[model samples]
Target: MASKNRKPPRVGDQPGFRRALIAAVLVVTAIFIVAPLVVIGVQAFSQGWAVYATAIADPDTLHAILLTVTTALIAVPINTAFGVAAAWAITKFDFWGRRFLLVVIEIPFSISPIVAGVAYLFVYGLQGLFGPALQSADIKILFALPGIVLASMFVTAPFVARELIPLMQAQGRDLEEAATSLGASGWRTFFSVTLPNIRWALLYGVVLCNARVMGEFGAVSVVSGNIRGQTNTLPLHIELLYHDYQTAGAFAAASILAVLAVVTLVAKVLLERRGAGRGGRPTLAANQTVPETTT
Candidate 1:
């Protein structure tokens, strides 16, 4: 008798088991990430826009929104610049203490935001170590706009750098050298070569940084003094509304932030997909073909 042969197992051979396991994991993860957002949305629309209108109508809430957007607009750019510079320094060049410097960049992430706030207070608050000097020069930091911006910058600084370092390292310096050899100036090479390579990572980092800056509460709360219409940010304003027994108003404000977060997440996914498509496409020239430069 001839020996019988058996077919190789396909991925779907164990379909029922695999499907059950995947379903369980997906359901759990979805609940973990989305349950709170659903609750907030339900609360926001439960009263048929009356609560949302009331929340938005409040002058204090309006001021907080303005302050939050303004601070994020200012701080995100500063952090992006810093992140790019830091990534360049760490990846493109070798230097003494470079390892130590990279470690220092992560300090803000490890330290509690409350601790960061308190540390800033020690340096900039009235009666702080630098208080006399600032007062003498008529400069204010604690309980002021500068303090809010500074705290936000500190918290969000690492996001871009962390995203860029690995990307820059993996990309290497080949394109940059090729551009330089082809009569491109250093600035031109950077803009034409380096920027395009890391643009997606940079944009993703900015989105995350902006989200964190907008949602930050502990650190900003400590320094902001929660002064209504003046120092209050959207997150702080939400807290105030919650404390004032305005549950619907609190959820309404929070729902706006949740919506923004969702929008940012969607944009990030689309951009990442675009980046992936670009990355997957073959370059016009393997040696040194100048591709169409993107602005």
Candidate 2:
């Protein structure tokens, strides 16, 4: 007898349609995001290497670049520490007003950086709340380096905490508990177990925080006083160049920032891929089958 014939599955069968749709959406999104970066890079190199050399060689531009790096180096670590502590406090403990504290920590992320600068000014500027006290001590915040660092710290504070909370929650407390049960002290458990688990997420947040600190303009502009070679950061320098009608210089400076951003993104991608690979590895099952009794 002949077997009954069955129709072959169509190429468009199953959830392939949804997968294709998602792929198309991702492609379009990638183009939308990358177009401006491509344009900036083209503009940066279009004027030849001489323009880049001139732009970077300028003393003011060089100073701004250095200041940007310095501010990020100082701010990122401080924020990372704050983020980790905040995340641990809010997630690992029960307390009154915990939700409120979390909301307050996130407020800076929602508020405009310019507004954050203004808020700082209200307290530290010449006419601000502490103006008299600061003046008496001969301390200057507005139009000074302190103001720039504070503003960057304010804006970047939430990055690491936001990345850490979900990670800690998903990871649960079993490993930590196990470590504690083994006679490990609190600090030992945290340093040896907790820190290792969350390090990648913290690093990811730091990379993002650094990128934002390097590129922040609105807040820096408010406090930097736009002092050439004094408080000027790379972003401020780019603005100054644009205002001075050195379009090529502006693009060149912008290109350097673009390169930094690209490097950060590449690092993030590689780290994420490594994390995923580690997570994908299978663990052995607790139960094992015995050999068959009857042969």
Candidate 3:
């Protein structure tokens, strides 16, 4: 009775040992994560605003940015559609080799990006199987835009499906069944019943995938040929600038990628927080939308 009547402990009331542990963690995080970010920000603007602006505004830099964005545009949409389809199929049905398929989808996560690029080269390079025929037709795959897009797709393919499959599986087919029984067509069922339930998670995966696509270096590097303004993406451009003794320019280019990382982190945090809320609503309704349904 006496304990129940006492006030609950506050954050500041943590034991000395616990507080010390937390402090240690904060210090380590600041030293590793925060310090690098600060260095990037400082070095990016180190040469003054005019120089920084000029560096980013350079024709080559602009082209690099455009190429990077274009790659994302091409890769993300295809991956998104594929992800939805794969997730639906994998989670809603049972089949032979389903586990094997899941493992195959997750291959990109385990392999190095550099190795992926090499594989692309061997398959599409001059001496490769289809290379001779493609070369005869003047169709380029290696060290070209197509190669870059393919690499990006290969690297980012699993993200969205990975996010959605487990979630859809957990949700079961109850809502989808309900919708179908109520006269919803297959398309209608997905749009009205399935989509709303997992939109946040889908978006989260897409955001992550986009970040990876934009920042992809190793695979793109092998396939891009580092053609000054033609195939060079932002990361490759950064390397170009640095090697050319353009210190400020390199950092300036890096800043854009850094900002993208920060934005992604922020979105992830916001979504997670919303997913955790539960005030006067269904527990999943905290920051979540209408109840989720499986495919």
Candidate 4:
């Protein structure tokens, strides 16, 4: 009885209510997160390994996968370039309408992708302003691969740019000025200094943007017309299969996307851990201060 009295309360102790609360939260997360993942994995292979392989290997499925990959490959690089250039201009050299440009860049995150899709359709469709000229020139923007790419670009336009804005702002222009003072060319300074400093943040944005580009449904759907083995992306193809009552095939196709999401999550975790180990976020320059780190 004396020893029990001297002992401190542990998680399993009678008075340890916090532990129980934590356990409940964790259980809730697992139910919503882990359980769904398990379901997708199981259903993906419900028809056995051989059938799952066939589902994934189907010609339409393969085409969808290729188009998705192509979209990301094109969109990611284009966005990366734009993000860097925008971040540089906004942070390094302030001009008229800087804040306004920032607001414009963030519009994508605030609005629904569906709205973006509809807006693009109106702008690029056969009845749009440029539609007549494009058709006269034998150019097809809507209901084709080019439309898919453009829609992706529209929705993912903001990611990398936004990620680098705060980072570059915090970094200030000290390094760039120093490099210039030392007679470094603009191109050299940018390649040698700015790129290295914001590499991680840039990568973080790119990974996220690419993930969205590959997974985009609504915008791509509006432009792609869901043509089987042609404009159909992975998400659309999955829907096509599901609509045809091919549950197994649909789930199998979905598994690839699920795996990609998991991989992206893991990469984000690694980047976070790496940043932490390196003392985390950089100090905001004297001109500006970084926001307080949040969980």
Candidate 5:
């Protein structure tokens, strides 16, 4: 009776309460996430392998795949570079308007992707600010590959920088300062000292950035003009297929993105286990040893 009346050591230590919480979470996950994924898989091959194969091989779908890949290839690396540079600048130095620069870098996160796409249209479209100049110069920026890439870049610009800043800020500048004092060049210090420590975090950021670039829809849709086989990306193409009542085709195309998302999730989990992710830091090398001393 006394034992029953006594409280558990922790707020959530009761077995019944724990079971209830776990059950609730599992139910939510199954309904919201696992169910949709299973549906996609089931529908993707619903018409059998031949139909799936045909949908996958369709020229429009293939073009969308290529365009998506092209956008990712171009955008990811540039954003990775920008992220690293911004993180380095913000964490490793003090300057005028430093806070302002940090805020500007994060503006992409606060603004809607659709809004950004519209702004790009105004800036580069035929009726836009530099529209006539670009037209006269035979330069095409809107409703083309360039516009798609630009919109994707804008939407995903903050991913790498957001991932790197916290980890870099936590790491501080002692290592770089010491390297500099020891006559190491800036490039050498960055490659040798800074790069090694931050590689995992950088890779984590790149993975997320690549995932976002491939999956991006809102901004890409607006700027791409949905030119079917021409400018349509995978996300846009999927919408087109679905709207045309090509459920199998849409699911097949969606399955590719789902697969990519799974791969990215796996990579993210692996990196997080390696001590890189949200609020995560890299672990030391296994080979490092402490010096022995005599008393």
Candidate 6:
């Protein structure tokens, strides 16, 4: 009779089950993620510091690094501005086709990078849409820095806006409206009221954007023409080295990208913590109403 009265065990309450799940997750992560990263590091330095340094200091590798950095420098900021404006327009105002604009902003996320690259080629290649005009004007777009930058920008365009849109939507426009009512200019309201509240998300988005720009391969590859020491970015450079059987050099170059990934992850974690600590809202100072301007 007492046995009949015993209740069923709750889900996830069994210690054995929990332990098994944890063990499975750890095993998978170690094999797939951790093991590969460890192998890259080990192989990169396997040939001694001199070899690794030589690989990194190679002229082609240096140019690749510079090209990657330059692409990121150009793409990230423009995308950031575009994202901020897009989010602001989508969330802070009611207008016709607002939903359409939102969908357009998200198009890049849905489209394949390689496909975007192909599309750019059709539009900018030697025999492409504006090709003749460009040729006549002596403007080179394909197989150059500009092509690489455009590809990177296209692939990373949505990052900042995607991060900001939901957060800003949740925040609504009350503070911005209040500030505007108190004689604050549009820029003033944005800088004072909106920026502080969304800074963490903005920063998180920028980090992710920058990381993607640096590591992008498919789209850039299609557009850049893989000119050694000219248009090849780091990822392409890594591939070139591996193809040439310079395995250590490839791994060394890949290590730089891995380091960037780690830094981005760290920044993401820090920003999440900071946002959580503040409830993802502006501080009290930012909440204060703007003083009205007197004549």
TM-score of each: 0.85, 0.83, 0.88, 0.88, 0.91, 0.90
Where model 6 places Cα greater than 4 Å from the true spot, the runs are 1-9, 276-295
RMSD of 3: 5.9
* Residue range 1-295, candidate 2, lDDT tens digits: 1342266556565478868988998898778987889988888778899988898889999999999999998999899999899878766666677666766776777788889888888889877999889989998877888889999999877777777766775676789889999999999988999999888887888888899999999988898899898999999999989999998899999999999999998988987865622221121210111111222
Give, for candidate 1, the lowest lDDT window spanning 10 residues: 281-290
TM-score of 1: 0.85
Candidate 4 ranges with C-alpha deviation above 4 Å? 1-15, 276-295
Over 158-272, each residue of candidate 4 has an lDDT whose tens digit, in order, gives 7787778777877889999999999999999999998898888888888888889989988888889889999999999999999999999999999999999999888878866
Which prediction has more favorable TM-score, 1 or 2? 1
Error of 6 at 164 (Å): 0.5
Best by lDDT: 5
lDDT digits (tens) for residues 18-82 of candidate 6: 89999999999999999998999999999999999999999999999999998899999999999
Candidate that scores best on TM-score:
5
lDDT of 1: 0.81
lDDT of each: 0.81, 0.81, 0.85, 0.83, 0.87, 0.85
lDDT of 1 by residue, 1-295 (tens): 2332265456665778788989999999889987888999998888887667987888988899999999999899999999999978776776677656766776677778999899889888876789889988999787878999999988776777777776776676788778889999988987888998888888888888899999999899999988999999999999999999888888888987998999888977887785622332222111111122223
lDDT score at residue 272, model 5, on the 0-100 scale: 89
Clashes of each: 0, 0, 0, 0, 0, 0
32-138 in candidate 3: lDDT tens per residue?
A: 99999999889989989999999999999999999999999999999999999988887777777676677777778777899999888888888777888889999
**Model 1 spans > 4 angstroms off:** 1-13, 181-183, 275-295
Q: Show pairs that collide, candidate 4.
A: none
What's the C-alpha lDDT at position 11 in model 2?
A: 58
lDDT of 5 by residue, 116-193 (tens): 988998999887899889999999888889999999999888788777777877788999999999999999999999
TM-score of 4: 0.88
